[model samples]
Target: MGIALKIVLALVSVILTISILLQSSNSAGMSGSIGGGAEQLFGKRKSQGYDAILSKVSTVTAVLFIVLSLILVAIE
Candidate 1:
């Protein structure tokens, strides 16, 4: 892939990684399901609510990841 695409994808991948890490997991026990984990300071609900930006970020990242993989394959 082009350098620009790689750079942008890298940056996006980093953000996506961070977003996913910050968000709670789907199967993180009752704490995750109930939004009552040890890290639940204010909000940070486990469920992907309407304002769950991480979910969107994750979706975009997943698409980007797939696209990048395809691009790499095509290049090879």
Candidate 2:
């Protein structure tokens, strides 16, 4: 009903979209894991380099998505 809330939600949706895209695949990449093998079964859980960033980003994005969805529903 309010313009401010609409703008905020739009901005949030954009950020959520961007962040989700910035993240690389859980697996290394296509050329490497595309075919498939035991290595493809899962990703290792360690405080490694990029993976740590990905994991953290995923968590924040997920929470934001949930919160934003709830807010939109409540507003409606």
Candidate 3:
């Protein structure tokens, strides 16, 4: 049981890492400073398609990672 739990934890860690990497960076920095005006004129930003799905997946994976870590600690 312990070994199986450890394997599941490892898989979840990998998934969490990949999902985080797949998500887009929120910081625009210099580019945002220049393009902020144009974006405002265009209106509110919308997240559609793959980005939205990836974002949700990242969130869920992150939560799973945390929960699994706690479970692993308890088992040990």
Candidate 4:
């Protein structure tokens, strides 16, 4: 059980990294970095198609990674 969980955790980590890398950058430079949060929060910017899918994938994988890490720690 522990070995299986470790394998799954490794896969999830790889997937999370890939999904993050595949997504397009939302911010431009210094200005965009400062204002990008508002744009995202207010729905001024939207993700479509590939970006949307990757965003969701990354989110889920990140959560899964954290949960798996905690579980592994607890098991140990």
Candidate 5:
């Protein structure tokens, strides 16, 4: 049971890491500067489509990761 929990914990950690990485950065930095006023004039679209999906998935996985961590501690 302990080993199973540990394995689940590891898998959740990996998923959390990947989901975080998959998320797009809020600030465009250089690219935004280069693009200039376009973002302002056009206005930033709300995160939709793929980004929205990733955001939701990442959120779910993050919660799962925390739960799994707690479970791992309990098992130990």
Candidate 6:
């Protein structure tokens, strides 16, 4: 059980990293850092197509990674 969990965790970690890397950057530079929050807050930026899918994938994988980590620790 422990070994299986470890393998799954490894896979999830890889997938999380890939999904994050595959997504397009929303900000350009220092200017974006300052105004990006306002744009997102006002719903000016919207995710579509591949970006949307990747965003959801990253979110779910991140949550799963956390849950799996906790479970693995508790079991040990």
The lDDT for every candidate, in the order shown, is 0.72, 0.68, 0.82, 0.90, 0.82, 0.93
- Model 5: weakest 10-residue lDDT segment is 31-40
lDDT of 2 by residue, 1-76 (tens): 5566667667767776776787666555666666555655675456577756766776776777677777778878
How does model 4 score by TM-score? Answer: 0.79
- TM-score each candidate: 0.57, 0.53, 0.77, 0.79, 0.72, 0.81
Please say which candidate is ahead in TM-score: 4 or 5.
Answer: 4
Residue by residue across 1-76, what tens digits does model 4's lDDT show?
9999999999999999999999888668898878777776787646578989999999999999999999999999
List of clashing residue pairs for candidate 2: none
Q: Candidate 4, clashing residue pairs?
A: none
- Pairwise lDDT winner, candidates 3 and 4: 4
Candidate 6 lands at a TM-score of 0.81
lDDT of 3 at 31: 82
Please give, for residues 1-76, the per-residue lDDT of candidate 5 as tens digits.
8888788878877887888898888777988778757877888886788788888888888898889888878767
* Candidate 6 lDDT: 0.93
lDDT of 6 at 36: 79
Top candidate (lDDT): 6
Name the runs in model 4 displaced over 4 angstroms: 30-43
**Per-model tally of clashing residue pairs:** 0, 0, 0, 0, 0, 0
RMSD of each: 6.7, 3.6, 2.5, 3.1, 2.9, 2.6
Runs in model 6 with CA error above 4 Å?
A: 30-42
Candidate 2 residue 63 Cα shift, in angstroms, is 2.0
